[model samples]
Target: MSEFRITGKAKLAGVIGHPVTHSLSPVLHNYWLARKEIDGAYVPLSVAPDVFVTAVKGLQASGFRGANVTIPHKEAAFAIADEVDPMARIAGSVNTLVFREDGTIHGSSTDGFGYIANLEADGIDVTALANRGPALLLGAGGAARSIATSLLEKGFQVIFSNRTAERADGLANELDAAWRRHFPKGDAPRLSTVAWDKWEEQLSELALVVNTTSLGMQGGPAPDWTPDLSRASSHLVVSDIVYVPQETLFLKAAKERGLTTSGGLGMLLHQARPGFKAWFGADTEVDEATAAYIRAALNKR
Candidate 1:
């Protein structure tokens, strides 16, 4: 740790995940650091699953303040954390880590808060519709788990749907939330799964549709599977966790049908927002100017 620290040099911060080359976090965060005039450098680290533990321990001991965790390793990150926030513990994932002076680690999962920030930015009223309508999620991966737990807390009825019914069912069971194999066909707004083939049929009662898969990421345009989002019966909002392309085909299809849409950028910023303040102090602000700059640069890719 002594060698890592230098007189009059920037502090170290970064993110860890497999194939982390796609991350724009360093860009987004560095802008904030500059604005705050903080003497720190943020970078992205590509740490594979097999090497994650060693890499994290090495980083902390080497004076790295903390880091953001991404896909394929959230659960494992949780296992290594000394303590976790309530949401992360319940979700069984960790997206942020803070290193204490005593070498103890504090972790938190920001996915839920990130999603909330995104939805709130779009003016979605989750509080007003508390338990009023059924929330439909499109995947059962790490991202889904965090968002689902958030939905449960907001008093919304949630339906877990995935290409694999068993996976969705498993998630629901873990959360103690009900799971359905098919989407609701009748007027009832119950939580149920919609077969991948029959997605169009279940689009009516879905108030919020969340995409947690990597469908609309860099090398893809989402799955060939498109659900009929043209239902006039309910206001369908399409939200995709993919931020790389900024706008995924899933959200684009929703807009073409005149439905509301959202992307992962909001979540990205909000998730990092808390940790930035925690590690850099409360005065640190990841302002809109910084976020806008990062978003524009990403669009060029």
Candidate 2:
């Protein structure tokens, strides 16, 4: 590792969360800074929910370039931003915040972009699935909102399934409205909600399956059951937004069935690109070396 040093005039960026001690964002950004020899510093700040707004304002006042917003702060970040990107508007959240020269804050959601980018990084041609068939989304939380919006925008019909039927239905309705308002008339995507217990019945009709919940993450509950991929389409792709274990049981089952699978690490890496550029005025690339570095670090945890 390059022993990069911090100077008084270094560009500043960070991540804001209620409990940020476990975040790898600082490691990701600092790696790029050291590699490029940029005079910048990226850190993590633990800010309580009540003081999030005040803390953000203070960062802006302190000449900090920008910060990544996580957890409870994404929605609040959107509300405080002077300008919001279209993706952020669609997702109703913001993970990246940019402080401009005029002292105004700009917010954007890179989660959707990161999702797609991660698929592409894994050699999955997501564009080829456009109009191919419906996709199965396995959650209705914030992460699912972004992935659902992205799938619809990419021309795939979405089937939302969540443990709470009402939440799934509500998310489908919200996404439908957002889809209509964002896309052209004929390009509008179709969305439907499936009961949690009935998700398995619809599996055969899907070409892609995405798990956006914490069910498979470390310390989270394991899935009650695994889908039988043998009966599903051979072209089906299984992806999970949980990367802590690197290979969740959901992904391992898919692999065992000779199906394509993608983990969440790429999303974490790809999502950091936009924020880094906004803060340091340089574009960063997520290459194999970077992935190896992160994987090694994750393995050590």
Model 2, which residues run further than 4 Å from truth? 1-4, 183-186, 223-225
**Residue 173 in candidate 2, Cα distance off native in Å:** 1.1
Per-residue lDDT of model 2, residues 170-227, tens digit only: 9888877766776646566688988888877776777899999887788777744355
Specify the highest-lDDT model's number: 2
Query: For model 2, which pairs clash?
Result: none
TM-score of each: 0.84, 0.94
Task: Compute the lDDT for candidate 2.
Answer: 0.86
Name the top TM-score candidate: 2
Worst 10 residues of 2 by lDDT: 223-232
Estimate, for each residue in 1-301, the C-alpha lDDT of model 1 and write its tens digit: 2343324566777889888887778887777776666777788999989989999999998888899888777888899999988767767889999888899989998889879877887777878645446778888888888998787667677788788889887787766532221212423223456665565566687677788877767766444535566663447777888877777777888888788788888788877788887776745443577668888878766
Backbone clash pairs for candidate 1 read 180-193, 182-193, 183-193
Model 1: weakest 10-residue lDDT segment is 177-186
The models' CA-based lDDT, in order, is: 0.76, 0.86
